[model samples]
Target: MSRIVLITGGQRSGKSEQAEALALSLSAHPVYMATAHVWDDEFRKRVEKHQQRRGAQWTNIEEERWLSRHDMTGRVVLVDCITLWLTNFLTDGQTTEQILQDAKDEFDRLTAQDATFIFVTNEIGSGGVSENALQRRFTDLQGWMNQYVASRADEVILMVSGIAVKIK
Candidate 1:
């Protein structure tokens, strides 16, 4: 059976770093699953920075949708975040239920493999309520997504100011 670890936190809260460390500890050659869809130069720069940080040792996989369709057997996988992945669905006009079902589908397929999955998501609901409708909708979707992944995860961690707090 596959092992699932869910890590959540606010922006720049060390969630990705924590997930990367844990994945490396689990497997010598873990897969870095890049889910970000760069929308501008700034974001592209950020992606470049992350790529530089990971270096050539990690196998990078650029996938934005249908996560379960990928073959990840016998490899540890690090999904830098559920937030960006879900955002892709939302931007593509996917309904909340559809987004969730897709996530669940990925979970089901992943658990049947021999891979160790580390998922990083943002705890976006903790901040003050959003005034924009789309922001609000995204927030709700992110919350639900985090909950679903955490519930199924063997280990759940919350990163706060670069410190990892074990939650499950």
Candidate 2:
């Protein structure tokens, strides 16, 4: 069976780096699914930095909000992070159920493809409770999304201080 790995950690926890490393170990070329939108100069610069780090070997695919079910196909596909993607979906006014359904569809598509998959996500639930309702909802959804993905993944890793701890 093809392996599906989920890497989750706090921001700047090197989850992306670790995901890339794991993708590199795969026998196939890595396809990077970048979900970040370059909305401003700072974000563009950050994206550039990430691109530079990944280098020219990776086949970069820009997938903003709600990746279509047909998008994930290659020898290995690494979704850089899912936090921004979730936020984009939420801000776009997608209902919670719709968001969950879309995510499930995308996950199914990835699993059905003949390729290894590495999903990177942020561990957003460990932070203190949010004061605002929207923030709280986002936090809850993020936790739920992570749980759903990890449940389906073959390997789940939590990164802390650049160290990976296998959770499942």
Clashing pairs in 2: none
The digit string of per-residue lDDT tens for model 2 on 34-117 reads 888677998899888888898667888888754545445556888877788777777668777787777777767667776788
lDDT of 1 by residue, 25-107 (tens): 88888899988989999999989988887856699898886677788998999987788888777765778788788777876
Clashing pairs in 1: none
TM-score of each: 0.95, 0.90
Worst 10 residues of 2 by lDDT: 65-74
Positional deviation of 84 in candidate 2, in angstroms?
A: 1.3
RMSD to native, candidate 2: 1.8
- Per-prediction tally of clashes: 0, 0
Residue 108 in model 2: lDDT: 70
CA-lDDT, candidates in order: 0.86, 0.82
- lDDT (C-alpha) at residue 40 in model 2: 92
